[model samples]
Target: MKNTLKISAITFIFSIGVLAQEIVDETLNTQVDANIPGVVAQKEIDNLDDQAKKLYYEFKDTVSEYEGLKRYDDQLEKIVFSQEDEIRDIIRQIDSLDNVNKEILPFLKETVDSLRKFVNLDMPFLKESRIARIDDLDSIILQSNVTTAEKFRKVFEAYQLEAALVIPLKHTRIYRA
Candidate 1:
């Protein structure tokens, strides 16, 4: 009976050890499965962060381009308005000219000088060839021994030519900021 009891006690301890080992293995497997989803979630979050950073930079670049276009448009507008005002003044002066007024000759020269200065300073890209042609005509008018009417006609012709060159540029669409 004593031997039988000792054998039963030993068997019970062995059974408990096997159960404990099985429980520990099951816990380890559950822990591993839980960690796999966490790792995948972290990877997805990192990818999303990278994509957001890329989009932010792209937006910034687009905004910068828009701002540059706006500035260019504003400059073009200023040039058009200034040129229009100058042309109108020239037309008014021509309409009021009398044939025998030598004083009007000096005024015409001054008007041409002002127009040339304005073009050079404000509209630098307005075809240089056209500007030169207009300048040549102005010089001829300034030095010619002609009536005020003749000078006015020549100046008016040059003014019309310059206006033709400027008008197309004015209607061009400017980009928005």
Candidate 2:
């Protein structure tokens, strides 16, 4: 009887220990199940924070680039305005030159006519050559290919040649011994 009672007590103790171990295991599983959603939520929050930081840096870089481009555009505008002013000044100079060119030809013709009259009235020194030079001037004036500046230069050169021929002859009385 004593041996049977001891065996029954031993079996009841072993069954209680197993029941306690099962209860502990069930509590731990429930706790792990309850915490899963919180862990998942923390991971999602960390990912979103990283993305926000990346987007903020990108925004900053974009803003910086826009400012730089705006400054460049303003500089270009100033340069364009300056170039437009220079173009207007050059146009005015060209217009004034056009007026001068229109008036010069008639004036040159009168001057050449006056020079021819003077040469004809002067002393007959170098007569044929001076006449030939005047004739050359007439032909140069009528030619289509010659520029007005060149024609004027030729006339000035002829006037210089005539001036060079005017030398004062020295008057000396011969004393007879």
Candidate 3:
């Protein structure tokens, strides 16, 4: 009995489906008739509109970036122009530095030599060490690695040490007797 009922239900559903085909669209050809010249599907129109919107936004972003680049270029030009005087001043300083370096080398050499002669002729306290220091200074001045400024600084420090040695630290001598 149950099998008979199931067969009847299937037959009824099949008959209804066959009759319902006339109500629905026959094929995709009827959905877009060949006779129409410019008719397109609603889904295609929606997709085209979306693509157009995306392109429009991209173009807007590109234009904004171009304007930003234009501003940056203008600012860069201004900075270059503003720095011209400073650049010239720095260049002059550098040129003068080279001249000073040339003039000072001979003076430094003479000073070092004079100090060496004085130390040799004077009383012999730490004499060898003093001569070694002068020798080191001579090598430092001649070295390509040491800058003129650094050599000058070293010479000044040596002069300070010599001055301290010559000058007494106290005016009154300590009488511990």
- Where model 1 places Cα greater than 4 Å from the true spot, the runs are 1-4, 86-177
Q: Give a tens-digit lDDT track for model 1, residues 5-61.
A: 999998999998999999999999999999999999999999999999999999999
lDDT of 3 by residue, 1-177 (tens): 889899998888887887677545555466557535345466678889999999999999999999999999999999998899789999999999999999999889998998899788866768888899999989998998999989999888888877776666335365767
lDDT of 2 by residue, 3-53 (tens): 999999999999999999999999999999989998999999999999999
| Models sorted by TM-score, best on top | 2, 3, 1
Question: Which candidate has the highest lDDT of all?
Answer: 2
Query: Residue 30, candidate 1: how far off, in angstroms?
Result: 1.2
TM-score of each: 0.45, 0.61, 0.57
lDDT value, residue 113 of candidate 1:
79
**C-alpha lDDT of all candidate models, in order:** 0.79, 0.85, 0.85
Ranking by lDDT: 2, 3, 1
